[model samples]
Target: MKALWVVGDIHGAYDKVRALLLRAGLIDFGGQWTGGDAHLVFLGDYVDRGPNGVGVIRLIRGLEGQARSAGGQVSALLGNHEVMFLAALVFKQGDPHDRLGFREYWLENGGQPRDADQIEPAELGWLAERPAMLRVGDWLLVHADSMVYLKMGGTIDDVNASVRAVLAHANPDDWGCS
Candidate 1:
């Protein structure tokens, strides 16, 4: 990797992400990430707090593939919003208008829904699979600070797996509330 482009919390700003990639000289007009062979590490928060959450997700997913094909790697980490969205998705199957509180939370925090209908089962499935953090070389990347948890591991995968396992159970606050 020539250079690693660490993107901050996008918060569903699809256009801003697009512009940064383009300005970085990576990716042509085709939405491909290609330049200086930089490894693109999106620091999560790709959804919620913007008008194009769905578009943002699709764009990043697409660019990850494209970047891989172009000899660069795109790693997207999980943020709190991602976790919230997943929680809402899981809750939605049991209740249609579920998470009114969650949606209001997003709105209060500056987010917009992409569509009420025409849901993409694939994207939702993907979100469920995202990890809590990403590790690259000696750097630890997470949507929010995880310094308190790093003592347990030297690798991002290790820490993420541990955190995710904790989040799997109910009453998530019990995990790191100490």
Candidate 2:
């Protein structure tokens, strides 16, 4: 098995991440993960805080495909920021507009409002379907700290089921089994 390169919350700042990766020799001048092609595990929070949230997302999405093509895989776990932006982007019935100020939040955190129109529906849908947690060997990758024990189905499918339940509810207090 190739070495697993687990990354933490980026909070955008694509240029910084790129520079660090380059300095560390993880990626090349062409922006490819050429250092041993390790299994890259992204620990979420790709958007929000810092500039270029959309660029960060696109870069990771592009890397996901490239990593897979290179016989390694990229595990992109869903963070709370992703959930917040997704809720703001998609129509949520009664008060969808109330959640529209995520752009402001992004700005406060050093990000600019992304052109939602430029993002394909299918890609957004794929992002919406991302799992909240990923178990890599004995380690667990999650966005926010768990409030209580989450009763996932003892498998990847089970974890996704639990995450879907939480996302469907859209209540911060009701996340995990407390």
Q: Which candidate has the top score in lDDT?
A: 1
Residue-level lDDT tens digits of model 2 in 1-178? 6677777788778898788767866678888866556777777777777567677778778777777777767778887677656655543334545344544543455444563445567667666777877787877777666653255556666777777776565553443232
Candidate 1 matches the true fold with a TM-score of: 0.77
In candidate 1, the residue pairs with backbone N, CA or C atoms under 3 Å apart (3 or more residues apart, or in different chains) clash, namely 26-34, 27-34, 49-110, 49-111
lDDT of each: 0.67, 0.66
Candidate 1, 12-35: lDDT as tens digits: 687887887888887677786666
Candidate 1, residue 96: how far the Cα is off, in Å? 12
- Candidate 1 lowest-lDDT run of ten: 169-178
Off by over 4 Å in 2: 91-111, 115-118, 148-156, 165-178
Residue pairs that clash (backbone atoms under 3 angstroms), model 2: none
